[model samples]
Target: MRWRAGVVAALAVAVLLGACGGGEEPVAATASRTPKPLPISTPTSIQQRCFVPVEGGLTTFTGPEGSTMPGAVLGEGADVAVFLHQTSAAGFCGWATYADWVASKDVKAVLVDLCGWGRSACKGGFAADAEAQVRLLVDWAREHGARRVTVVGASMGGAIALGVGQRAGADALVDLSGPAVWQGVPTAGEAAKETTVPLLLAVAPGDRGMDPPALRAAVKAAPAKHKRFVSTRGSHGWDMLNDGALTEPKWSPLAHDVLAWVKGEYRAG
Candidate 1:
């Protein structure tokens, strides 16, 4: 698959930011500007199984046969949320909070430890080779009778998910704190040009390290008929996890919004 050049440029920027010894100023500033309102609904939590093996070694994580991913399941039936963790993070790291949020909306949630990360084997890092692992996960989701798979990826995981959504089939793709382009990774625009699935591009207002302009440019280049951009407050991955203020809202309106979009697309077909 073809990677995005813009993503490469953005990754360079990230590296530069890191080299400058800068803290998360962009994200913090953005968060400060937004109102700290709680979610409208409280979400529940569910646990599930995932298992898959990659080139590095045999995966020992949970999941059904033919899959080796550690994840949790929430909600019921076809309304499912599949969460992909970032690099060096486990499925359970911040899964419960998101799972509970999804469950409150009655949406089943599946949080997976990606290959080479968490309990899964690592053949090569998040390089081009990671694409195979993503493909395997997508295939497993389809085989397991998943009516519709809505993928949410964070950081490196977001990059992987974008690659999968670009070439592999999926219902919807959500990019959280993921750069439009990573080092040798495809930009969301590049992925969008080839992907048929609905795409939601989300960026943290405070992520000065990230170039939202580049991401927006990529979205404009995407081929998907349905594409939307959302701006969230706080650091890249912090807001969605347990430590964030939106961890448990009285009403999980965000989950509902995501599910509504997925269901609309699934039903349209």
Candidate 2:
């Protein structure tokens, strides 16, 4: 679209101007002071805004013309929540564990397709700045009445999630196998240290991508009153969500159980 093309031109200059900078943003075409809202089009697939995971689950989310492919929004209910996938898992569908949990609790889910890769790639097929993509999702949530949002991010998505957790005013955050540092972006550990929201940082001892030592350190430093750390046997991220997988896979029920706790399933009236 012409919109993405214009943004590409601006970002090209910005990328050229900054070499050793953080990747935390996007470039959108300028809008008039009073712009008209894009007409909402009937979605090609209800699966985009429906329950259950499916093959090639990517969906289109409009920006200005109601025709852009921003990402997928899942579930449909009162409690608004957002889920971010890992960089490696982009465009893939493995959130059934978390989605099931949310569905059981009657929560509305916004499953952000980690843009810049796979099926979530930007409209112009150019890489979007990581942080900018996150801000876009969070801002969209805000405008759509997603208050007290809960954020769940894994790996690269976890880092970006932390970068905006407090800014998004999330009530709670869950980080699975997220690294303390990545590609010059501010570490989730740093954000953990500063946030007061309830946080649960889970990591497998053998998780190759996530740094256990730094995660433990950050967890210790986090000032959140309800923060907790779980060292489980599952691989990482959604892999840790496996509670009923084969016995030999080094499985753990951390994902399903912790989510139950974070959403206050354990709280008594």
Model 2, poorest ten-residue lDDT window?
49-58
Each model's C-alpha lDDT? 0.59, 0.61
TM-score of each: 0.64, 0.65
Deviation (Å) of 236 in candidate 1: 1.6
- lDDT for each residue of candidate 2 in 64-157, tens digit (9 for 90 to 100): 3222444555555545666777765434345544555565566666765565544454544223455455555657766777645667777766
Q: What digit string (tens of lDDT, one per residue) describes model 1 on residues 107-136?
A: 666665665465554443332355555555
**Count of clashing pairs, candidate 2:** 3
Q: Pick the candidate with the highest TM-score.
A: 2
* Whole-model alpha-carbon lDDT for candidate 2: 0.61
Off by over 4 Å in 1: 1-67, 123-128, 238-255, 265-269
